[model samples]
Target: MATSGDETTAVRGTFGFNAPAEVVFGVLTDPDRATRWLPVGVTAEPAPGGRLLVRGGGHRAEYDVDIDPDRLEVRWRPATGTGPHGSARVGDAPAGGSEVSAEVRAPLDEDRLRRLLGETVTHLRRDVEDNFNAG
Candidate 1:
């Protein structure tokens, strides 16, 4: 399940996953696992003040990473951009599984933000099912 709020400058979306919170958090924090689901090719340290390198379209840019294990959240912003920050947080869902709430603010329009968020969720689901549900 996915839900979105009405906003133009920023986009907020909640996605439901059939994976546990710890598993979801691990996928976000572990560099090797994260690279499998992240939209772009990224090399991140996954720590506070760590460098996050995003590569796509033959272009590469650096961003700062902020991770909070207690909060189950990770945030990042470009090292040079005026202001396009993004974050993803995982929590236990009401019924079962986990819920991932994501937000991207400024510079990116609502449509683009929604698309990116949706893409990430799709990849995340596939990865979890393939890696975690194998029997």
Candidate 2:
């Protein structure tokens, strides 16, 4: 719920899936799945002072985590390009599925920011859901 007024600057969304937090967490943190959502290739060195270079998914923002920020919020982006900083947080849903919230800062027009964040969320949800269903 990030939409505020007729002109919002950031876009935040939450998605639920029929999977567990651990299951969905892997989808977001695993480097193998980086290309599925990240803007650029995965270059996280798995350390606190590691170098990260992500420039894909339309936007081109760049930032670093303080040694993985709970080992979950690894996604980063700069404000210059079209990139958005996003992360996936999973929790147990009352109905048994897992809830994943994606907080993205799209530094673009309201329309484009919303659209990009929405599409990114949908794609990630589908991928994780499909993976769960397949198992």
Per-model TM-score on C-alpha atoms = 0.77, 0.65
RMSD of each: 4.4, 4.9
Per-residue lDDT of candidate 1, residues 1-135 (tens digit): 223434336778888888788888877766657666766653334433466666654656677778899999999888875555688999999666999998877555667667777777888888877766873
Off by over 4 Å in 1: 1-8, 40-49
lDDT of 2 at 93: 81
Q: How many residue pairs clash per model?
A: 0, 13
Q: Which candidate tops lDDT?
A: 1
For candidate 2, lDDT tens digit of each residue in 15-107? Answer: 777777766776766545545653223333232334344544442334554225354444555424444455556677876777776666644
Candidates' C-alpha lDDT: 0.73, 0.57
Q: Worst 10-residue stretch by lDDT in candidate 2?
A: 39-48
